[model samples]
Target: MRVTDLTLGILTLLGGIAIYLSAMNFQAIPGQEYGAGTMPRAVAFVTGLTGLYMIVEAIMSGNRGIGFRFAEWTRSGAALARVATVLLLILGYILVSPIVGFVPTTIVVLVVAMLTLGTRLVPAVIVSVVATIVIQQSFGKLLLVPLPRSDFLSFLW
Candidate 1:
């Protein structure tokens, strides 16, 4: 189905409001000028304002109701197949990450996706590994966020 900007804007606005409200409950860090909730609240406010602007633009442009064109969206089988493949791959990653570890799961998903999209084997593997390393380093080292480690292979990291 084709969802209009108006509908998406409304949903975004609601989500932003909810996020902002929930983030307000977070406690400020001791002796810190900016609290832990500051970033989340700022992000929510920006999202909400952006959505509100979109809603206003949609209304001014005379687009009132949402347009739902299901048939028009599903006419191409190949397009649908690609979309489904990516979605299923994401679901697979989520389901298997804890078992195989986050790094391996991400690399597998990326390599498979690249190969399915007609990339060469060497390039696909290289790109996937590089991307995975970059992401792991960025989140784990730079951001101090912990990634899932496989029980069997936790020593590798």
Candidate 2:
């Protein structure tokens, strides 16, 4: 766990740095308000600070457990399979969204992911469908963000 913490800390630090650098690309807005980069830069700074704290804590504790040994293919294979499944599901949604539309695509993706994560079929399907509708409505109506909707489901609009 210590080694895992250290690794994650290092990765977080690197990611924070990357985010900070990327945020530099956004130009600051004039006198009225904050620029697009402001929030991201702030988040990056905080993340980097937290990561540094984690590293310092790890070093001070001196608990060096067994680190990552890729010699064991079983764990690595399982991790890869999980990642691949998620990627495939996401890709499937992107490909099918235009045809079946956003709600259906999102429903299918969510259900598959929930099932893959070991949820029972009935509950998974129910939760997935409900959550998709809620999220879609929240974003489309409350947030006023236009979500893709099928022409067939135009009545909802």
Compare the candidates by lDDT and give the number of the best one.
1
Candidate 1: regions farther than 4 A off: 3-73, 151-156
Tens digits of per-residue lDDT for model 1 on 19-119? 89999878888887679799999999999998899899989998877755566648988778878989999999889987888888988999989977889
The superposed Cα distance between candidate 2 and the true structure at residue 38, in angstroms, equals 23
TM-score of every candidate: 0.52, 0.50
Structure candidate 2, residue pairs in collision: none
User: Any residue pairs clashing in model 1, and if so which?
Assistant: none
Query: Could you tell me how far off, in angstroms, the CA of residue 139 lies in candidate 1 after the best superposition?
Result: 1.0
Full-model lDDT for every candidate: 0.85, 0.79
